[model samples]
Target: MPKTLDDELHTAGAGASGRRERAASVPRVAWLIGPALVAGVAYLDPGNVASNMTAGAQYGYLLVWVVVLGNVMAWLIQYLSAKLGIVTGRSLPEVLGARITNRWGRRAYWLQAELVAMATDLAEVIGGAVALNLLFGVPLLWGGLITGTVSIALLVLQSRRGPRTFEFVIMGLLAIIAIGFTVGVFIAPPDPGGLLAGLVPRFADTNSVLLAASILGATIMPHAIYAHSALTRDRFATRRGGPGARRDSGDPTRRIAWHGFGISRPADEPAPAPGTSTEVPTGVLVRATRWDVSIAMAIAGTVNLCILLLAAVNLAGVEGTDSLEGAYAALGVALGPVVATLFAVGLLASGLASTSVGAYAGAEIMHGLLHVRVPLILRRLVTLIPALAILWLGFDPTLSLVLSQVVLSFGIPFALVPLVVLTAKVGVLGQWRNHWATTAAGVGASVFLIVLNGVLLWLVFTGA
Candidate 1:
């Protein structure tokens, strides 16, 4: 006979015991670190490079506050996303999907999200193509093809080897990105006084306001918010009546343990009574998640700042430094070939790693929001088409990257408003629902982002 849901849960719980025993030998914190790092890749994609480079090159330290502000807000937002998944065992998209009862409303929501994800892909694939051209003189069309192909391979790795392995590989790429982008700052540091002065919130012109929006868009990505919740859900959520279950049970102390990485109840602890709460040790998980998010954001934020500072100190007021290709050539002239090559390498790594993550986010978005599970390969191809088309049509790659970020900025409110609403709902998260202060902060960030995008539109339309 086919097994029932309870039978499946029992089998899963039994299977988890051995893995938990094995995990007991490892450090507890190691189990919680990977998800945020993977999600954080969104903040460092090619869009970020284009936005920050243009900001510093064109304005020279004028928009430093935007980068810093975006990062600060990202920390709070990412933490809320992770907390929602951990407490409820559902991703943001999954939650939104189940709650939006109207079919047309659900489709409408998915459409905007789909556009945002495609914009993300366009930036990443284009960045890869530009990097390949810079490094090996590959034509843009072929380079885009190669980039898309390699990203598919990475997604395949995630499918076959599991999330832990995928995390390790992405983390390795992140290291290369960090080193590649930040090495130049050491070779030629920014003016300390100018850097300090840039901290004061101000804009140089309408163009600077546009770059600031692009920077915020590149930094606080909608897909990353969607992905982080899903990442946590995948990594930590348990089967029904298994670990991390939300239902109440007889045994109050029967906390959830790591499923594959192996944290289990101590040998001395009493066995869980039948029908115990399936809740994991949420306090422990939340603490670890905070550390995970902090580390990931710190790395992403530093690399982005370094990219801007590199351009500000060296490429400021330089003609033809606004584009990635132009910036690469200018870096070679100003800081020599080694620095330029490293920057290209970092851009390449950023493209490769972030595209894989972006593709993963797109897949989750479809599955959760539409409740339709398309094959990953098929989904990857569909998204890859837009980026490739831009390259084939001979649109300016750097300009495309920056504009794509601006598009992302516009989509931010759709993701952020719903997230703030859901996570703050008492019925949704129970005791873990946002406190007044947290909810207010989320509201404030959402409002600020909305206002910033409005200013960008006004400036463009009015020519102010």
Candidate 2:
């Protein structure tokens, strides 16, 4: 066999050159893609449409800033999670699982993951069923069954074909989303300044509190954290290093490595010395992560922004949709039955998209929490059963979906506080840890959200 130069180089110094190749092959604004495709479409879920519509129609563009603010915060959070995954070779769960000395810390993380997964499933099952009801005149029970079946089917297809194939299909659906939203904006053009004003924060009585809560819930989610972590781990090709191979694993050394593609030998045996040079795998992991987060978050943010704008123009100022029921009625009046049907279907999509994400997140939680490792088939059934039953019992679909968002809303502050504390610690993220500017931005964002949420809750209770 004649060894070509490429082949020899590939065999001889694959790690170094492959890493170099990775640097050179960085996606051109293709960097702007991957993560966005993951979150953006899901963000455009039918429930989000209703929230934005409810906001815009009632407040007319006044609350648009709420969505923007939530997204800006989300961008920062997702970036940090991905960056940590890259730098640490650990998802938040793994990081927390190992870092927290106490059992309670570990237990809390497990509980949250489990609750979020179940709540998310509830939202998705109901949303999909509702959409079926709108589209095919299917009953709630039948629609729930259908949604469960279809989502399971989609999961099978995704697992078999891989993420690229699955994400591509979702991206196409997102395009349809863009078309639908863009057309909606055209059909009922919003006031430009009013839309602009919506970006500003204003607090008052009325159900503006509820509107704010909805926007926050739709934009910031616990599943996204799990999804981002798992995705980062999946996207990153890791070295199967064994015990005592530490090249300063916890030192958080300020090193950055990039990779194109390289062959790796499984950790054969004990290595030579501390100063001896072997590429640190964690460095490469972190860099790729930043790329993933930056690209994905940008796309998700833009589409989310568009949804708010669309709502501002079409439904924000309308009189009818003061509540969920009002939203259905206003939708019919403004865009007629055809468009209203589309919104319901959109809601269904939101639930379905998020449900799958919920299940995936749940699986990860199980791995971290109960140390349970159920097969994916069993896992799917376990989550689906409760959700379907809820639908069958005549649980109010819209309200239940809305509650899922609320759970997400609360989960954000809890999940993020730990993330900030854990990653900022010198022991965990080391050189890749949060710097001054980043820490400030993250903490400020979390606090602001908590305060807004508090106000929302206060109003909800007092009916102020």
Candidate 3:
């Protein structure tokens, strides 16, 4: 017999026994922070640093609204992605692969997703290499190679340590980024009136629209769209009624014992008796997931906002500030070396951690779309080669990062279209399928992105 929703949730919550006892002492919201933080890395990567910095340096706070809009869209999409994993017990790629009955369609999707992954890695590697060049005087080509090597080492570390350990590492790096940017905002605050006005939302011209699109691509990354589901799926070893019906044995890494994630229940709510149907609804879990995504994205959005604000304040009129390195130097001269170093350090941290996350997403994309499991190491190497070639060809690193994000914008439809389709399908999601409001929002966001990409491509070709 198939397990009911209550059966699946109760079985999953069984892992909370010790957690429940401990929760009697502390809070549970803190437990859900890790997976969302991992997902949030997608928004705070080197691509975002490049795009947000460019927006601030070029247009000042005029483009701040774009960053805000991009992050809001990202959080919505990421929430759906995580909920999909939680409800279906499968990642988005795995779901898409199952649904794409035609072999040719799967292959085509796989090709586009691979290209997207490469674009993502290109930005991350360039950011890492640029950071190395800025801080240590390493040459770009050599820095590229070192960046690749260090990324591999981090991947190896993750495999050895398991997912929870890996997540803690990412969270630590995210903290560094948060601290650096917070200090930056203190040093170079944006004009309060102008910053508030930027939130009013009107593009000044065509170039502003293009930059906004790039920022959207950078914030709502395709790889992240693929990876979040996998991350959440891994958080629970079982879906609902399938197998052992027990919580995963994987040691959850949290500072405090997570008693339970019952958003619908009061803090003092008693645990449901074992083997009894708990009145706790699946909606409770869903709400809890959104809370996690909200907290994580809120932090990420703030960081991105700070990046744009810093650039607007310090590098708005500075020549040659288009690149991350130039921005660092300008900040140093305008503020101090410590502020400059913080920016470089934040970039480096973003580069390293997001590269690792990007690699994980690439693996998911390959395995999901193609059903072919390439070794993770081989996948990382495959993506690394293109970044190396870009450096070897002497492309400007900052410009390359910006162009890579633009390429990512072009690839968004492949992921977004399918994501919207699957989440709305009642057959797949059952009670958790998107409500009408969510469906409308998802479709609207998807259409908006597609139209934006269309306009961008037309602009590029016609030189309008």
Candidate 4:
């Protein structure tokens, strides 16, 4: 029989595992630090740039608390998502797909998830177009087309080269993004007193509240939550011995294990004798994942803060800095053309890296939920059309980016609520189930996000 995609992925994962075991002198944790970094790209997407930059330019440092709070919540949320995949050997969508037996009900859920993915692609494509126009004077529509094409190339890299090579490429772009966004903060430092005050968590008014919601929306992305699980599953999950290894006996415990990191045990497996080493390989990878998630989140959080601080120090109260192009022009006037050019370069990198990841997440959503696979070219073209049409219609890119994030914020509960519930359930994760404290934190974060979105709607609708 021909190998399926899953078989290929499992084989690749197992090969990586074999290589890791052979090189025992190196830290195993080092080998396990990649999936979260790929998912972290979603946090630094163009919607994030628009929301954080707008907040800083319009409200100064007043909403810094929002950005910080969102990252903190994101750490917990993403860890839970990855944990679900690690423990169950399945992505959240796949788990849900199997459990929700009703066909129409499954289809309905897929629709909403599909919409969230489309919204993510919209922000990414528009951001790329804006970057191209700023850097090379390309027309927005043409720039958007270029961005989509490049992203298609990236998807090809992921498919043909397997994920490890793709991770290296994305990480390279991540370095460019980090340098591009943060160098300005060092050149023109933010006020110490104002920056400290922004951490106190008080809102100035309805407008500040609106910006806060946008920041939260951008920071804690739904697609990132979905993608992290699948990424980890692809990297870590496999049969006990290897991809096609068979059980020596009828015992189920010997039948299942996460290749490389012996995480999962089949439900029917017997317990080891008391004298045997009680430690499972799951702990090693889980600990490594903590380091992975922490490092990724720290980098994402810092870059995001630098973006806000860059605007607060250089563009606050400056007229016409509300949009990205305006912000680019303002950065040139205040700092220099060098700083402005770097910002555009970073934006371009962000757009290219993130849109590719977003497309991967969308593909996972479809395959996991609907149990169907579409050609990558067709999937890319379908999602690319709405973004290109928006550019052709001449809608303001920055505003569209911000609104797309709000749409993401609304989709958060659907992904998050299920994650918390499943991770808390002993049936789903067995010994690896979430501790009460972790579940409480997840619940609190989900509630906080839900309430903030409600307040945003109320203020907008009531004209407060």
TM per model? 0.89, 0.80, 0.86, 0.87
- The window of 10 residues in a row where model 3 has the poorest summed lDDT is 248-257
Off by over 4 Å in 4: 1-27, 240-280
RMSD values for the candidates in order, in angstroms, are 7.5, 6.9, 7.2, 8.1
Q: Any runs in candidate 3 off by more than 4 Å, and if so which?
A: 1-27, 239-284
lDDT per residue (tens digit) for residues 58-131 in model 4: 98899899899999999999998887776666777888888889999999999999999999999999999999
* Best candidate according to TM-score: 1
lDDT of 2 by residue, 1-464 (tens): 96542333234334544553222222222422354456445565545655666666666667777777877787778777766655555566666665666777678768877777677677677777877776777998888888877778767767776555566666666665555454555667667777666667786555777777877877777777766665554444244542112234364332322222221223453433343323433444454446655655566666566656666655655765544445655667877776666556555566566566667667766765555678765788888887788777877766677667777777778678877776677776667678888888889988987887888778778877
Q: All candidates' lDDT scores?
A: 0.86, 0.63, 0.79, 0.84
Which has the higher TM-score value, candidate number 2 or candidate number 4?
4
lDDT of 3 by residue, 16-121 (tens): 4533211222223354456778978878888888888998999988988888888888888998888787667678899899889999999988898899899999
Candidate 2 to truth, TM: 0.80
In model 1, the runs with Cα more than 4 Å from the true position are: 1-27, 241-254, 259-280
Top-lDDT structure, candidate number: 1
Q: Model 2, 286: alpha-carbon shift in Å?
A: 5.1
Cα RMSD for predicted model 4: 8.1
Candidate with more favorable, higher TM-score: 1 or 2: 1
In model 1, what is the error at residue 270, expressed in angstroms?
A: 21
Ranking by TM-score: 1, 4, 3, 2
